[model samples]
Structure formats: structure tokens, C-alpha cells
Target: MQEPTLLILTALADEPRHGYGLIQEIEAISAGRYRMRTGTLYGALDRLLSQQLIAVEREEVVDGRARRFYTLTGQGRAALAAEAERLRSVAAEAERRLHVLRPGLQGGAA
Candidate 1:
């Protein structure tokens, strides 16, 4: 839906990740722009799972505490690809506009 939400879906697109792992991945992927709280993370997870975009792939205990891993569904993959494409398109347009306006926005590329 939004950037953080889209980022969450993108992170989960690569592989199954537990809640905490998903948070870490998103933070890393976005270079720390998206820091997800447990409440917000779980809320998004529930919505995605309910929409059949993601599924609980497995549950296990590492040190006596249970954790669940979630994997993206086919629908999730398509959505992620579409979202990525959209973001890329936006970035490309931004770069084109910057080229017209500043003419050195790329920092030594031109």
C-alpha cells in the first residue's frame, strides 16, 4: 500500500522470514528507513496472510520460544514485482526530471 508496507512485502518476497527477521530485513533493504514495530508488523502480516499474499510457512523454537516463518504466495510475488516496477518507474522519472533541472544531480555522472 505504502512505502513501508511495500517494503515489507518486498522483503518477504525473497524468502520466508520470521517477524523479527522481517523487520531487520526491511530496515536493511531500505537503508534503515523502515523500522517496523511488532504491532504494526503483525497487523500487516495478518492482512497479507488473509489476502493470501503470504502464508505462515513454518513454526519452530530456537531457544524454547516459538517463532513463525512466513513465505510469500504466488500472488505476493506478482504484487511485489509490480510494486518494484512502479518504484523503478518513479525513480527513473525523478532522475529524468533532475537531469533537466539541476543537470548535475547524479554527482559527476554528467
Candidate 2:
């Protein structure tokens, strides 16, 4: 999964979130590295929800607006962990290659 997607998953790992809350959490978690426009955020949410990786837990009204709260399913947790492991594996391999190529210290910078 892409980092943005993984980041959404990570944010939800903390708690269930509605659309706007999820958006804010992802941005915060990324240290402002990621900021999703509504279009892209909803697209990713739809895909994950359809896959049963995330589910609508409930709905609430705030300021007369209905908001759907989403939570990670067990499958979602597993998926997030698998994605993280995959990234870690690839990162480790890349660093190893960097060590061989450049032999310098940015934790084996290439």
C-alpha cells in the first residue's frame, strides 16, 4: 500500500474517525507531509471500505451535518501490519544496497 493509504490506516489505528477527522489525523501523523484533498481522501476511503478493511461504525450529526464514523476491521489491522512489514523489508534491502554502494553513515546511505 502507498504511504498515504498506510497513514490513513495508522491514524484509524488510534481510534474511529469521521471523514474530516480522518483527514486531520492523517495530516498530523505525517507531520504535514500529507494533506489530502477531499476527492482523493474519499476515493481511498471508498476502496478500503469496499474491501471490508474498514467499516462504518456509526453515524453522528454535528452542526446539522451527518457524519459517518469509520473503524478498522480485524482485516484492516492485519492489512496495515502486512503493509508495514512489506515497507520495512524493502527499506532494509535498500539500505543494505546503499551500504554496499556508498559505505557511508546515513544509516548506510547510498
Task: Give the per-residue lDDT of model 2 (tens digit) for 10-47.
Answer: 98997899999998998999899899888998999999
RMSD of each: 4.1, 4.0
Cα lDDT of all candidates, in order?
0.87, 0.89
**What TM-score should be assigned to candidate 1?**
0.84
Estimate, for each residue in 1-110, the C-alpha lDDT of model 1 and write its tens digit: 77767877888877899999999998999898778899999999998889998999999997887899999899988888888898899999999976685555646656
Clashing pairs in 2: none
